[model samples]
Target: MTEVLFYHLQNMALESVLPPLLEKSLERGWRVVVQSTSEERADALDAHLWTYRDDSFLPHATWRVADAADQPIILAIEEGNPNRAQVRFLVDSAAVPADADGYERMVLVFNGDDADALAAARAAWTDCKARGFTATYWQTDERGRWQRKN
Candidate 1:
């Protein structure tokens, strides 16, 4: 079973989607491990989650690009998922939380219809993949929905 962190809303803003998704995941039936930029998002989703007391938030520390060993996977989600990770995640994608999990081999998504941003993002995804990680295009529909390239 794949653990998924679904980030969605009528408007798709962090403030709008984070709370309800947390609540939905906490019905006590889902066993998905979520990671967000901070515990604030987690706490906002579920009160039982590990959050910092008095507003500090349950974060070990933020991740920095300075550490070469732990590079992040890149994904451009049509609609990003919710996260409550204890560390700050660096993002280059418009979808803040990336996917359910970062990939050892990335399954990159692109809007081939866009023609320009697609080309650039594809290049970036390719560079990461070339370093022994997997990369390929998952073309999107006209409304920016994902349909894996078969």
Candidate 2:
């Protein structure tokens, strides 16, 4: 069964939070696909990942790249997994894809301060549970450490 995780971001920006998670995913030897809500967002994420940290590097490309299959991470605005990733990260209120179960894990990263994002994350949580996926919720503590809530 696919393990679904909901990451609620309250005081942090996605740009600050995502790179480390992506790096950790790579450390686990998991290929990743980050699905955003728009082409512009995807492009921005692609660029950010490349320069997020001076001491780090993430091997990635956009879905439009000819060698997408060869990348460890791929930024996309749609459902298909062009990179054959084992994990998928959904950002910017991106919906849970219909093909959610195709991956080993699905992560929904939402802005807690955004009303629409909170609502969408709630709905996605319900949907994942109904589909029998092992869904878990996580929130950052006062010091920005992730603590699993449920």
> Which structure among the candidates has the greatest TM-score?
2
Candidate 1 residue 33 C-alpha distance from true site, Å: 13
lDDT by residue (1-150, candidate 1, tens digit) is: 112111111222433333333344334333223333344543443343234235433221122224312322111123332232222212122322333234222222223345553554555555444444333344336664534453
| Over 4 Å off, model 1 | 1-109, 140-146
TM-score for candidate 2, please give it.
Answer: 0.98
> lDDT scores for all predictions?
0.32, 0.93
Q: After superposition on all CA atoms, how large is the RMSD of candidate 2?
A: 0.7
Q: What is the TM-score of each predicted model, taking all chains together? A: 0.28, 0.98
Which ten residues in a row are the worst by lDDT in model 2?
Answer: 49-58
